[model samples]
Each structure stands twice: as C-alpha cells, then as structure tokens.
Target: MRLKLLAAIGLAATLYSCDDTTTGIGDFVADTDEITASAQTFEATTKTLKYTDLNPNGVFSRTSNAYLGKFTDPDFGTYTTDFITQINCTEDFEFPETMQDIVSTTLELSYSSFFGDSLAPMRVRVDMLNREIDDDGEDLGLYYTSYNPEDFYNKNEEALAEQDYAVRDNSWTKEEIDSIKKANGYYPPLVIDLDKARKAKGEETFSAFLKRKYNEDKKNFKDSYSFIHNVLPGFYVHNTSGEGSILYIGAIWLRMKVSYLIESSSGKVDSLVYTSIPFAATNEVYMSTRLSNSGDNLEKLAAETHNTYLKTPAGLCTEVKLPLKEMYEALGNDTLNSVSMAFTKYKNISENSANNPYKMGTPKNLLLIRKSEVNDFFEQKQNYDSKTSFLGTYSSTTNSYSFSQVNRLISQIFSDMRTKEEPAEGWDEYNTLVLIPVKTETDSQGNTIGLSHDLEVNSAKLVGGEDGEKIKMEVIYTKPKFNK
Candidate 1:
C-alpha cells in the first residue's frame, strides 16, 4: 500500500515538474496509484582494444605529457614506451660559430610525477629521426603503436645523445608546489649534453647550422620546417634498460649553449657570450606505447566474478547496456526524477607491496560514454556533461564508482518519449555505455577542462559480476499524467 502511495506521489511530482495539467491524485485514488523507483543490476562485457585503435594523437596536454619506462608485470605482461618530439628554435639568432665557442649543451626534460621504483636506475637513449614525418604521417610520428624505432633512424648508426633519468624525483602535487615558499622547488630540470650532436652529424651540427642561418645566404636552415629538412628530423627517447619505473615526462626540449665571439661596433673586441638555441614548442611531438606481451586480458579478469574492467594504454574497457526501452514502456505518462549507478572496485591485495606498477595505481576515476560517441570522445577530446556525458571519481575508501547523474539522464529520456513516438534520438539510441579508464586534465584552479586516455599506461579492475550486488542502477520515476 505504501509503495503504491509513493508511486502516486512521485507521479504527481513528475507531472508538476513537466508542467502537465492532469497528473494530480483524485479523492478516490488508492495507494496503488503511487509510482516508485527501482534498482536494477546488469552484467557488463569487458574487451581488449588494439594499439592501432587507441587514437593516441593529442591525447596528452603540455602539462601532463607521456610516460617513459619499461615494466614487466607477472600478470599484465611487459609494457614499454618510446617518446619522439620535435623542437624548433625560437628567437632566431644570426651568428657564426666555431667548435671552440660551443660551451655547455643540454637536453632538458621537466616532469610532474612518476610511477614505479624511484631508486631503480633507468637508461634512456635519444636518437635523431632522419626521415621527414609528422603526427599526420601514415606511418611516422602519429604512427601505429607497433612502430619500430629502426624504421625512422638506426640507433646503431645515429646515436646523437642519451640520458639516465630518475623517475622518482621529489615530485609534489600542483597545489603543494604552488604553496611552496621557495622559488625553485618544482620538478628538477633534466639537462643532458647535446654538444656532441653538432660534431656527430658532420657539418649538420646545430652550431654550423646556426652559423649558416646567422651568416651566409641561408636557403635551407631559415625556418623550423626548413631546419628539420636540412639537418635532422627529430629526436626519439626510449628505454634501454631497467623495468624499474615509468616517468611522466611533462615537457621536453633540446638546449644548445654555444659560446660565440660577438664583435663590438668599436675596434675593441667584446668578451664571448653564450647564445642558447632551443628546439621547443614550435614543432610537433608524439609518443608511442608497446604492450610487449599478451598480459592485456580485461575480459579474463571478469570471468573470475562476471564483472567488467577498464584498463589503459590500449588495454581494456567495460560495456554497460541499460534496458531503457523496457523502462520507458513501464513509465507510461510519468516522468523520471533521476537515475544513477555505482560500480564497485576490486582491491588488488597482492599489489599492496611497495611495487613499481603498484606505485602508480590505476585510474582514480572513469568515464561512462555512449557507444556511438566513444570514437569522437577520445579522438576529439571531449568532456563530461551531466546530460549525455558522465564521469565518476573512485574513492578507495568507498570502494565504488558512484555516478549521481543517472536520474537526470533518465528524466531526459522520459521527456523524449513524450515528444516523439518510436525509436527516440540521441542518447536514447545508445543502450550501451562504455566505462573507459581516463585521466582528466584540469586547470591550476582545479576545474577540469578536458579528458584524456591511454596516455598514462595504467590499468584497473572493477566489479561487474552477476548474482551479487555488483553494478547497481537506481531509477526514480513517476507515472504519466492523464488529461482532465
């Protein structure tokens, strides 16, 4: 009797919210006329995504760049990454250079954070690309994840520069860094010698190139693209040894400090001053990931309990199908208050050790996207809206990914049913939503501006099993209003 009364009151609320004229309860109306909300649990399917399908281009921003490291996990297989970036000279200088004038040269890489063993030693070899390629290339910068380094430049023949980077630095969060009293507590800059680079590639050395650009009739080394064409393509940084950790390389650049003799207008000569030319933001950069082995098994993880999962870097995702059509028919003339879901997270007790991969645990949040919009969402870089797009953050203490936007979504669907007849449009068409592991990008103020995926190279497990309290969706709905 109470259930019927609640349903009746809910129906009245829905009609009133919808501005309907005939949804009020009558004097003779019994408690049976009440409308009620229901909770439904469904099974989600897990699947693996191919490296080519991840759409890695432009997934990362300037602040949080790609990760560099190699990790061999017992269950997740071996994962390695190669970072390729193009740096262009800013504020061109016209000058002649002698090898003697070349002072200290370094390649600087700034990082925000890291994952894996901090004390573990890792070697990164930097190679120059001889071939002309851009992110748009068919098999170049933005090429497949299976891209081979040898295809662009043979490291054995062209070892330009290298560095042994420490992933685990005294890295702090953005807020902590902002609160620091010191002016220089930020991520320590990685500086490596690029001085040999000029001498290694013969006359193509950056010193000579700069001299030519600064002096004679320079036809080739005029602009950034021209410079890439005349001398070198770009640089590729990859792991040589150490599966200890993966460093989150934020922004990278090659700085060449050349000591040059600048003559004064007077007869007297001025002391030599160092001129630094950096290949920075002017050019394009791309990073690739190699899964190395067959550890990617999101579907298999679900088998132990019938739940779904959302991993990363071409790993896995969960597909959720909601029975909206059936629910729509049952609601009749009623409107919905809201709907929401809570997917439980699985705790990996075995990974609790102070481990490398465990150090950088999986996503703290996940995005629930429509099946049709999945492609555009990832490739185009879309954000969440309470209506069609929704993302929920996971609280380890809570052990569940709870989404509160479900009610609003259901209400919109109920409104759609009132406006149209058969097979509605937009979100209504997508009965299945994919729970994709993602890293959200936010401003310094902590307001999220965009969404990114597969760049972090992490994995996570979730509960989607049947015959238990797995993925729970609750719908608060009311009956339709009949005309007076």
Candidate 2:
C-alpha cells in the first residue's frame, strides 16, 4: 500500500505543468487507480494600506548608503532627508610629536549618485553633536525615520561647516571627467572646510580645538566609544539652503591637514611635510537619518479605491487579503503542488512629462509577508523563508511583481488552520499580508543573500484595490478519489 501511494504521489507531481483542469490517475498509470489530479485558479482580494510608521531601529541594517538634500514630487509630495552619524576614530591614535601647525580641517561627503537636478544648487551644513547617539552605553531606541535632530543638538549654535554646491561639477568638462575617472578610478569628494575661524566669529578654529582636546586627554582616543562620548560626539548633517537634489552618500569622513617638520640626520629641518588624518563614519559606530514627508498627496492616494500605491523611504505600502479558508473548502485534502500570484503595475505616464522631469522611479524589489510579522521581520533582521514570507522581483515586460511558486506559504496557512480549535470562517488577520519595497543584496552569481528596507525615493502603482481588478491566484493540486 505504501509503494502504491508513493507511486501515485510521484505521478501527480509531474502534473504541475498541466493546464487548469482535472485529470485521472489512470491516464498516467497503465492500470486504473483511485486517485485524481487537478489545477484551479482563484481570485484573491488585495487592498492598499498606509505604511508610514516605519522604525528601522538602526539605519545601518536598512541601508549602508546615506541621503541628504530635499526634493518635491508632484505625485508623492515633498521629502527632505538629513542624517546624524558618529565618526569612528582609530584606537590609540596620536598626532605626530613634531607637529608644527594645523593647516586645515574639512568634511568630505563622497557619493556615487544623486536624484533630481544635478545642477541644482544646495547648501549642506555640518553641526557638532553635543549629545551621544547611544543612551549611556545602551541602544538609543529612537532611530526612526521621523527622528528629531533638535533633541540631540542645539540648532541655535554655530554650525561647524557649511558649503553651497551642486551635485555635478560643471567646472570639469565631460572629457576631463572621463580622463580623471580613467586615471584615478573615482572623482573627488565635496569638501567642506571646518577650520572657519576667519569666517566665523569664534576665537579658536575647530581644528585647533580638536588638537587641544587630543593633547589634553589621551585616554579618550582609546576607542570609538571613548572618542564619540568624551572627545568628539558626532555631527548632524542637514540641508540649510537650496533644494531639488538628493545625494546618495556612500561614505563621509573628516580630514585634518597638519604641517609637520621633517628632520634630517644632521638635526636640520629638511622639508615641511603636510598630510591628512581621517576619521570616518564606519560601520563600527551608529548612524541614522531623519526623513520627513510633507503635503496631503499620500493621504489622498491611500483613500483611493481603485489602484493601490507602493512608496519607499517612510511612504505607503499595499495590503493583500487572501481567502485561505475558501481555497481549503474548494480543494479539500488536496496536495498543493504550486501556487502563483501576480500584481500588475500600472504604467507610469509621468516619466515623459517635461515639467516634472525628475520623478521617482518604481521599486525594483517587493516583499510580501504576513501583516502581523512585518514588524518582527525587520526588527529581527529575518530573510525570506518562503513559507510566511516571500520576495518578488518586478518584471518590466509583464509590468508586474510575480511570485512563481508559493506552495509552501499555502501549506503553512493550511497547517495553521488545522491547529485551530474550530475552522476559520472568514478573512482574519492571519489571511492578510503586506507588500513592502525592499533592497536586496545578492552574491556574484545573482542569488539574493540579504534583504533590507530600500531607503530610496521610489513609487509604484499596482492594479489592485477595493474597486479595482482582483488579483488572480493560480493553484495546482492533486487529490485522491476513493473507489466506489
């Protein structure tokens, strides 16, 4: 009996590629059998829900890239981003004993790309942080998208440095940029000079202050902890003036130039050596971004009953409600072979617009997970398990994000129903799922190894809502037919 059952299941598994219809076991088997196979399609209702309350706990987990500047979208409204980061200091770092004078101190913001008008002028301000990011050697727990920088530093105080610049360097020609890139492999960073004693009303320069602190206390330079807490806390980087562009800053570092005497063997000064010492915002320390969204566009879109929307960087997400109990009742005791669903995206017409030229693009990746586990999934830093959670990539050809096989998710839902005291009748919290925009980390072979919340400016309009076209879920299963 066990051999016959195994043979029947093995044959039924091959019918996964068959059309949506019922098939008898005797068709594959030479002899008549008591089992049958079938495939069915069902419409699963999905609705768009607001996903504005995102708390990443720490920004590092979500994205390594930091953002700065402000941009206003016609569809999504205005978004402004600024960041606060702790600079990492080398352990037991010390200045040269023959140091003569501080030449200059500058903050370099290095970026790979930017969104919006590259020629748009913007002023970035760097302020010295007086408060520690961590709460007395513990996690701050206030690292949300809506974090307030005023709580950490006084805005009324004089800023350490500020620079008015554009994202693209217009001074360098295209040929010059190409030649420089070919030779150096990268472009120069936007340097903001911190030693502004001549410009500001202060008596001492910031560089001299740093040198004085280092000389006064050597123990504070022991590690990043002591350095951030005692010596130099951190910096609050914000946009003080201008708009229209947001830079995708990959790394930020503070460089201090010092002129020191290089002595010869005869005890004579040979040359005045000038070099820079850098303190960077590495992964060893904490960094967070404060994101703010203005205007009533999001609220207006969320209330729409037709097409649903998906936005990123503390924006909206779509909610889907699947009829699991209905599927169970329709296909009772069937071995679910494969389950597939697709969310078609509406073609964006605003991309070709002349006025709003720099609109946000659609998110490339989407995460479909149970609504109840959304918080735990991000907080615990869990990957897609394909049971209660799944990852879907957007297809430009089909204009959809399709989950090819979700049989395990269907099986898990059925397993949960079996454990209940009574059969679940209607749609509940367990049947609902959320669609989130995510950033995926893949290996060299293009296999996704890690997942995080995408902190980019993106939006997608999916064709499924209360009054919209219902999403179709295809299910292929095999069930037994008892002999009469």
Candidate 3:
C-alpha cells in the first residue's frame, strides 16, 4: 500500500507538470488516488415576495433623501410618498432687534432629480403640526416609511400653504433655465409661499406668528427640541393632487425673508439689508416618510414566475431558497472550493417606447443576506462580511450582479449542519436568502462606508424563479477519491 501511495504521488506530480491549469493539491491527483477534485453547477430556486418593514421600532434609522409626489407605472401601479419632518432651529436662535418686517416666508423643496414625467402637473400641501414628533424616550424614534402624518396634525383644518407645480419649471424659458443651470449647476427649488395663515380666520400670518413668538420669549428658540415642542412643532408635507411624477427631495428649508435697517455709526438709518434666515430639516431632528402603493398590477407582477422583480422603498424583494442540504448530501465530506452565482437583469423594453418613455433604472447596488438575519443586519448597520452576507454591484456592460465566490457561505452552512445531532430536516426555511436593493455610501477614496435601504425610485427584473429558469450556482469541491 505504501509503495502504491508513493507511485500515485509521483503520477500526480507528472500530471501537474503536463497541465498548467492544475490549481490545488487535489487537482493534481487522479480519481484513483487518495484525493480527487471536480466541479458541478446546481440550480437555486428563486421567487419574488412582497417586502415591508414597518416594525414599531423602524425600518431605517435615517435616510439621505425624502421622496415626494405620486407616480403610476404602466405595470406596477401607483406609488405615493409623503413626509413629516421637524425643521431644526439653531441653539440660541434669534433675529436682529432692528429687524423691520417680514418680506416673505417660503418653504423650499430642494431636489437634485426626479422620476417620471417632468411636465406632469402636481399639487403639494403643507400644514403646521399641532403636536411634536415623539423621539425622546428610552427607545430611539421610529423612522419607517409607513408613518401616519395625521397623527401629528389635523387634516380637517386648513393647511398652511399649497402650490400647483411641475417637476420641470414651465414658467422659465429654455434660455433662462440654461443660464440658471450654468450659474448654479442645477435648477432652483420648488418654492411654496407660506406667508399667509389659512388655519384660522382673522389670525396672524405664518411669518408674523414666528416674529411674535420670538418677541414673546427668546428661550423658545433655545434649541431644536425646545423649538419643535414649544414654538413650532414641524410641518406635514404631502401631495394633495399629483400623478406620473416623484421628486427626490434632498432637503427641505423654511426661509424667512427679513428687511432690516442698516444704521450708520451715528445710529442713523442708512440703508436696508434684505436677508433670509433658514431653518432646515436635518439629521438632528426627526423625519419620517409615508409610502403608499395601490393597484392590482403590482400584485400581478409579484406573482410572476418567469421573472423576479425588485422594487425599492417598501416594495418587493426576491427570495432565494438555497439547497444547502442537497449540496451536503451530494458532496458528503468534500471541501467547497468556490461557489459563483450571478443574477442577470432583463433589459428595459419601455426605454425606447414613445408612450412610456420614463422608466426607472435598476438599483445600483444589491445585498444578498440570510432571511433570518436581515432585520438584525440592517438594524445594526452592518456591512457585508462576504460570508453569510454578501454585496453585489450592478455591471452595466453585462447587465448583471454577480458574486464571484461564496465558498465561505457554503462552508458556514455545512458547518452548521454538522453540529446537529440528526440530519436537519426543517432548516430549509432558515437556509433561505433575500436580495434587497441598497444605497451604499462611499468615502472620498471610493470605499463603501455605509449601507441602507434604497429610498429612491428603482425597479429591476431578474431572470430567475421557481417555474421559470432557475439561477445557476457553480460549485467547485474536492473529496476523497474513495468517497467519490
């Protein structure tokens, strides 16, 4: 037997010399030797499932931008988004004592981009909150996308302001828009005047009310907490009328234009200085968005078996049922070398269509994680460990998101199976994984530093499902020649 083993080693070395493709010690050995190497591909079952994370705690702690307006997709139905936010007031905030009067009070919704028809007419309404957002307690504030704004304000009462506008400024000529873009690199915000108070008749204007509050007590402007609780609660902003458009609002600003008298050294009024004080919605204060979806079209799409869909901001996610037990049974005591899986996106056919020209693009980043660990993983803001959790970037050239190697994931799953006294029978449910759309925050060096649920508008159709073509997962492994 010893002589035969030595002969096998010598033969394996000769094989390695002849084949430059030999990768490992097992690869050099023949099937008759002590160790053998081989590769095989398995099909993984996948299907789309409706996703919602409206837990009492929160779905996300914070978001980079707020979504507003309503958009109806040809296949996916109608999506409406609204937000309630507390504007931050600087600590010890105060207006100059020489301030003459309020010129204008405007709520500016600043956005870098929007989805859907630019010319679609939309109406937005803003109302002052009667109660403060509950954020101060043992538990952190709830920041999910399904919050109710009616809890903070009275919908029956008149709103502070409402405006009819479009995603693109129809009032500005092409030349004027180009000039503004040349100077600012972007267009101006959708400004809504809030000077008039519509809540009550014979009452002070919204700007006058702010001035009066500051005059009454300066302590009310001591900090954001005090300001939101005492002086001004916040604002509940929603679309009263709109369709076929959704704006990705980056920031919300409440600007108060003031005309102050500039005095000379002798205390004589010389000139007037017009300026604006801005109170903005920031991370320090609480902000929540409410997302609503309607229509049977979305239901029909989610039930599609030929292809799986991925939609963002409280939409569907593809669930993959990994056959770990089957893999273990096939390769009893083998060592998993590598496992590669890729999800190819279906090209958008509506891109070239004249009727439905505006189509949402696929999510730039995706996360593959175990279904059981998803909530904890996101709640803890954990990054992909490349083991149980992995990240895939979309490749425009190939139109696919591929995970080149997941051998660690396979090894981990197998290790878990070994610890059980008996063969794990009902663990298939826990062995499942989910694919989620994510927005990744990168550093200056282009390294990903943070990950969160993508709140922007995005849709993707992947080629995989139970009744459709199953996703192919290439697995490479080595085992004892006798076992094989």
Candidate 4:
C-alpha cells in the first residue's frame, strides 16, 4: 500500500508563438497569446542530513589512552530509541510577527496544536534537522593523570626518557630571545645567561627568564605565552534552505530549515538550529481538524514504533546496557564503592530457584508484552471485576493504562525506529519480559562479574513455579464485535 504524504501541490506553465505573412507589404501579420513559466507537481520529495562518521569504520580507537575536553551544548545527550512522531508544521504559513524569535530559537520546534487535517507531523523533520553523538564513554585515565602523586611520578619518568628534547631552563638563543621580545613588544629583561643555560637546559628546570617575565612583567608575557600550538578538532555545518508546503488554496506557505553548531574540541555536532517561517495569505483558513487528524495518526504510528523496538532483541540489549553504564559511573573510583554498586546494579537467581522466568523490578528492566496478551489480561479482569476499563487508569498495584496512553508511548518508539522496510505490527494485546541481574561482585583486580541466580514465570504460565507451573487464570469477558 502506498503511504499518504503530508504535503501535496501542483504547478502550471504555458508557452506561446506567433507567425507573420511576409509575402508582400499588404500581407497581414497574425499575433497569438501564450503562457510561460509555471511550477510542476512532484510525486514525492525527501531529504536527509547526516554526519560523516568520524570513526569511518564505526569503530572506536584501538589505543587505550584517553583525553579530557570541555563539554559543549548538545554534545552528550541521550537518544530515545522510541519512535516519536510529532506534527512539525502547526502554525499557518503567515509571516511570523516577531522575526527575531526565528533567529534566537529552534525555528522547527516540535509542538501540538489544534489545526488542519488532524495529521500529526512526522518528527523526521527534527531528527533530520539534528545530529546524534554518544559522549557517554567514561575515561578512567582522566582521574589518575590529573592528580594521584604516583601517576604524576610515572609521567615524570616517561618525560625524563627524552630529557635531551625537553624544554631548556635558560637556553634561549639571541634570535629566540629577540622573537619573544618582539612578540611581547619588549626586549628580554636580560640576555639568556650562557652558563645557566648549559647547567639547567638538561636538568628539566623552568627557565629563570620565563619566571621573571611571569612574575614581573606579566602583562608583556601574556601575549608571548599563547597556546596556539594546541591541537584540536572541530565540526562545521552551514544550512542552505528550508522545506515549504502549501496547505490550502491561497493559504500561507510554511518553510523550515536545518542547521547546527559544531563542537571544536572533538569535531562533533554540538547543537541543532531549526528555522521555520509562515507566509501570510488572506482566506477563511482553519487547520484544527487537519491538525487533530494528523495528531491522531501520529499517535497511532508512535505506538506501533514503540512496541516493535522494545520487543526486538537489539532493543532489549540496549535497554540492559544503558543502566549498567550509568550505575558504573555512579560508583566512582573507590574499589569498595564500585563493587557494592555493581552488585546492586546486577541481581540474578540460581538455576534451581522456584521462580521460572525471573522477576525484574528495576526501571531498566524492560517488559515487552504481546499486545494480545495485554488485551486478554484486561478482558479477563473486566469480566470477573466490574471496574473502570480505561487503559490509562491504573489500579493500586498494576499500573493501569488507557489505549491512548499505550498508543502514544508505542508511537514515540516507532518514530525512533524510523525505517520504511520495517513492517508495522498491531496492538492486539501486549505483554512484557523483565530482565534481572541476581549475582554480582568485584574480583581482586576490581573487575565486576554477574550471574543469574533464580528463575520466574514463563510465557505459557503467566505466574507459576520454576518448573513451569501454570497460573489458574480465567477470562470471562470477550472483545466486542461490530457487523452489518
């Protein structure tokens, strides 16, 4: 089936020609009218902006060494794997009253409002507008290198190996001294003492001349002691234009553009800048119904995306990994603290434990339930107990959800997993799988290990024993049917 597009427009053009009867002076010349220069219709249009993978092979560096750099805005943010379908174009294409706001804020901000077609805007506009960088990597090296007397001593040893090439204490040549004086708009207070230079040049001592310059004539030295030699990387982006669409007859044209600043230290995208504009047109124009319908569609699509992502093995793996990294960071450098945190983070069970599938209660423990199973659970509850069946409403124990709530969540997930090739699934019912780490501890070398300790209920038996004991559950109510 062909997917419906959000924007559709048509353009027209015409051409003309004229002929002359020049047989004689009496011959009459004929003139004709013609049309020219019209816009054409496009079946579809799509564009995407992507960052060239800095690590071209998509692999991290092999060197074990690490570096510390200043953090930039939008440098280390989380990527919600869940699909998030949203309406990008809500305002009519009327020229914005405050043009300055366009420059200060993200022009293509995502927002929901009462407007045309009830169609939810595809958040692709936003993701397409921005870039993602995983700055979550923790560098343990930064800790010891900065302080730790032992590390400092070891670094000194490394430096001593190339002592001959190290900075000289007083070995400033006349030319070098002159260059520095000219750079700072002054002559060196005194010429480099030749005897002092010979004695301290290989001794790894700071230059006495440099010290005097810093302590006495600090202002003059500031210009001479610059860090221009520092090696750094950066990413640069330049936006060219915006995407526009005509909503209604004589309606305004909504336009949006994508741009972002770059991180100079690591040469990565720092933040995204979106620019949008609305053209003005006079007409009895209203887009509430259209916006509402779009919103509804987006809600549906988001829900579909959420389930498909969480239920997948890769999604489950990512769900498991994110928390582990966070927990490790929280533990800090203390061995005991790290060990305790590790155990707390990873809890498991024994093979012979009574529980079957294993019960996980952590927020990171993602529960992916089949849509059918969830509906069945609700239907069963409604039959035996007469209570509010709204999916959003929850009981004191089990978190109750409304269809809309679940759909929205799922739809957001779908937006994250945007791909035309991926098949969409229906929410007939829903169920979930929980991940629990039972056994965890640190070894002598400070490495943490985890082991599964127990088992819990399985699919066939919603709640049962480790040996696959089934719950004596029953469903009295059934889904309603509509027919002619």
Q: For candidate 3, which ten residues in a row score worst on lDDT? A: 19-28
Write candidate 1's Cα lDDT for 399-441 as tens digits. 8777866645555555656666676564447466677777777
lDDT of 4 by residue, 189-254 (tens): 211121233234554222232233334433432221120011001011111121111011111222
- Alpha-carbon local distance difference test for all models: 0.57, 0.75, 0.76, 0.20
Could you tell which candidate, 2 or 3, scores higher by TM-score? Answer: 2
Clashing pairs in 3: none
lDDT tens digits, residues 24-103, model 2? 21223322355455557877777666665333332323456688989888877888999888889898887777888777
Model 4 local distance difference test score: 0.20
**After superposition on all CA atoms, what RMSD does each candidate show versus the true structure?**
6.5, 5.5, 6.0, 32.0
Top candidate by TM-score: 2
lDDT of 4 at 414: 32
Return whichever of 3 and 4 wins on TM-score: 3
Whole-model lDDT, candidate 3? Answer: 0.76
Off by over 4 Å in 3: 1-36, 53-61, 136-141, 179-185, 197-202, 269-271, 349-355, 422-425, 480-484
Give per-model TM-scores: 0.74, 0.87, 0.86, 0.17
Instruction: List where candidate 4 sits over 4 angstroms from the true fold.
Output: 1-86, 91-93, 96-101, 107-126, 129-462, 473-484
Worst 10 residues of 2 by lDDT: 23-32
Flag the better candidate by lDDT, 1 or 4.
Answer: 1
